[model samples]
Target chain A: MAKYSKFAAVGLLLAFPLLVSSDYYRHIMILALMWVVIGSSWNLLAGYTGQISFGHAIFFGVGAYSAGLCTTKLGISAWWGMLIGGPMAMLFGFVLGAICFRLRGTYFNLATLALAEILRLVAKSWVSLTEGMMGILTIQTFRSKVPYYYLAFGIAALCVFAIWAIIRSKWGYYFVAIREDQDAAEHLGISAFRYKSISLLVSSFFTGVAGAFYMNYMGFIDPDVVFSLYYISIMAILVAIIGGAGMIWGPPVGAFIMVLLQELFRSAFFGYLPKWISEAHAMAFGILVIVVIRFMANGVVGDWVKLSGLFTRQKAPIPSVTSGN
Target chain B: MEMFIQMLVAGILIGGIYALIGLGMTLIMGVMRIINLAHGQLMMVAMYITYVLYFYLGIDPYFALLVAMPALFLLGVAIQKYFLNPLLKIDSIIPQNQILMTVGVGIVLTETIRFIFRSDYKSVKTSYSSATFMIGNISWNVPMFVAFGLAVALTAGLFIFLLKTDAGKSVRATAQNKDAAMIMGINADWITQLTYGLGAAMAAAGGTLLLPIYYLFPDVGSQFTLKAFIITVLGGMGSTVGAIVGGIVLGIAETLGATYISMDLKDAFGMVIFVVVLVFMPGGLKELTKV
Candidate 1:
């Protein structure tokens, strides 16, 4: 029954666009799917590997610019970014890890953040290379949302599966071991730096793909939109964190919740609420972060039993052999 | 040579203010073992307080400092007590939960300010704002000179407090070892609260001082937050004197960068220096000073 749920969820998602005719809902789903890719990748690095990155936007922006530049410079279809973006981001990931993996915890976080800021600044100023703040614009290849929706769905599914596979693999254990205690992992002869870089590589690749997908779907790119610390970097963290970090299902759950919340606020609850409520969207994200961190440290999925128990007004059931397995 | 001296003097003057900001972060880092990522947001809140007092009440920014500092101290104490302290007891996968909380707090603070002030670029224009005096070949902005003097005086006062006060000793002790401090009957919880308050107050003072010369916006806190941490890192995580020197160095580097290396890349200079310092001299200036 539990094994079939994954299939059920995927099947439902695959059929979602077909069931829902509204372009509005389709666009929201596409955004949610994109976030799944970004959030899951972030989880793989920060949640599983204990390398909390505050600059996932660096890879994200690189992936975005990789696609955007292909159109502007290479004079190719932006679709090529779908192929090139991941690797381009992975390249950045390698450099970032090489420079930053030497530092631990907060220092690593700061380094990633600082590097991303540098990139944002460069992307804004280097007019010859990046078109500066003018941004890269391209015509959307598909007028129908279905094609983009499916692409986003496919990428998200692939990313989740890859992360799931990695976590189940020996590499996953090494990552977790490093997260638990780097010194202990080292004592056990696991090269912390090597595995961390590998985790970052995979993470950046998927995130880069998402960024590229964003370019193709949105049909436009800007430094402020792509490399924004508040909108992209922190949003990725919020997604992984809101869903429950360290769990395979966490980011997917979180991505949906966040995107839905964002849209609801952005549209002022489908025009029911006052427009002023829409302006408070970022503030809402901030408050959600605080609330989640305060009461639900492990997030909804991680504390499912406790959460459900509250609804049922019953003691959270202790896991029996069948349930535990 | 005159231009060089001008830049140097300007750097030192601004560096004094940066030192005050860095001192706040250093104190928090020393005591809490966590980087108060919202250090600059706290300063921003203080700046807003000062701004309100100046704009609405016709009070001087320097005078506004009295209200801003204590108000921010209380705000900081409340945050430490409620938001950060509880996280210490919660079992979570992420060890940097407190730091993450600070980020959330920073966002909320910035957004709240934006909601109120609407992201307008505001500055407190005083009669002395543009007043200057010539000394030798270099002309000094009067406000900058006064701000520098106030920063020095605050630093001196802080040093005396830390060295002479029993409460300050307890703070240092708690920073050294929380468990040991608890065993010694010092209220580690209260000390953490007090340290956070002091850190916030110092940042508030720095912000209040900067109000005359610098422009204010909701997003300004983030830039200072980056600068504060950079200064803290450069000074060596928990070293006060090191932070002061680091601040001055950053001030000089930024001014020089602005003059010679495109004015736009001035902020980048600090970041480049930060990465360089992290890579080569992880110990920061503290390794050399060892104070």
Candidate 2:
């Protein structure tokens, strides 16, 4: 039954484009799928490896710029970004890990954040290379949303599958061990730093791919859009946290919920509600983050049993507090 | 040489204000062992409060500090007591949930202010907003100089409170060791809340001081929040003395960077220095002074 449910879910996703003809819903799904990849990558590093990064935007923007630069500099199809973006992101990840992994806890988080800010500034100021704030624009291939949707779906699946394989492997144990207690893991002969770097490499690779995909899908790239600290970095954290950090299905579930909620609020319930509610979308996300962290720290997938328990009461009756006698 | 002196003077004056912001962050970090990402948003809230007082009632931004500081203290206390304090019990995978929560709170704060004031840049145009004074070859903005004096006085007051008072000692005790502080009858929870409140008040004071010279907007908090953390890290996490030194150093570095380097990359210099400090001088100035 469990296997059937999993297959059923996959089948539903595979057939989603065929089932839904509207571009609006399809666009939202593509975004949700992209987030799934990004969120899962973040979860691999922060959730599993215990090195919480406050700057996934650095990798994201790098992936995006790699794709954008391919078109302008190389004059090749932006589709080529899919091939190089992940590797480029991984290269950045290696350097970032070398610098940040030496530090622990808050220091690591801060370094990543500072680096992301630096990248944003560089992307903004380096006019000769990046065209500065003018941003890189490209003509997207394939007008239909189906191709993009399938591409997003494939990447998300590949990301999730790769992460699942890694987690089940011996390296997964090392990652978990490092997360639980780096010192204890070291005592057992596991090199914490090496495993952490591996985790980051795979994580950033998938995130970079997502970034490249975004460039292709959106057909435009800007430092503010891609490298935004609040929108990209923080949003990734929110997706992972809201869905359940350590669980495999967490980010996928989180991505869908977050993307849907954002669209719902952004459109003000498909324009049925007042326009003022549209402005409150960011605030809605803020409130959602607070509520989720406060109440559902384990997220939707991690706390499935608890969530289900709320709806389906137990058959066992409670004993009377006072004795009948 | 003249430009250098002018930049130094400007940096030092701004650094004094920055120190107040950093002091609050350092205090919260010391007590909670968590980075309060909302520190700048709290300051922004205070700035808005001051703006309201100044624009509507004709209250001076300096005098409005009295209202802004107390109000922010309450807001900070409420946040710590209600929102943050509860998280201590909720078992979760991420130990950084509190920090994440602060990010959320910061967003809500910024968006709420945005909803109320809109995104238009607002500034308190006091008579002294553009006034300047000359001391030999170097000139200092009048509002900035006055702000620097007030900031110094506030720092002195905070130092006295920290060094001389019972509550202040309890805060230090809690920061050092929560369990030990509890055993020593220090009510660690109350101290945590008090420290947060005090931190918020300090940030509020900084925002109020900066109002006359600096522009105000809803998103202004995030910029200062970054600046505050940079100062905190530069000062050697959780060290008040370190925060002061870090603030001044950062101010000077930023001023010089803006003057000499591309103005567009002014913010990058502080971040670069922050990363360098994290890598090489992890203990910040605190390690040098051994404070």
Q: Largest DockQ belongs to which candidate?
A: 2
The candidate 1 chain B region of ten consecutive residues with least summed lDDT is B90-99
Candidate 2 per-residue lDDT, tens place, A232-314, comes to 99889889988989878899999998999989999999999999999999999899889999998988887777777778964
Write down the TM-score of model 1's second chain: 0.99
Task: Please report the candidate that would top lDDT against the real structure.
Answer: 2
- Measured against the true structure, the TM-scores of the candidates, in listed sequence, are 0.98, 0.97
Where does the lowest 10-residue lDDT sum fall in candidate 2 chain B?
A: B131-140
Show where candidate 1 strays beyond 4 Å: A317-325
The alpha-carbon lDDT assigned to residue B155 of candidate 1 equals 93
Candidate 2 residue A82 Cα shift, in angstroms, is 1.0
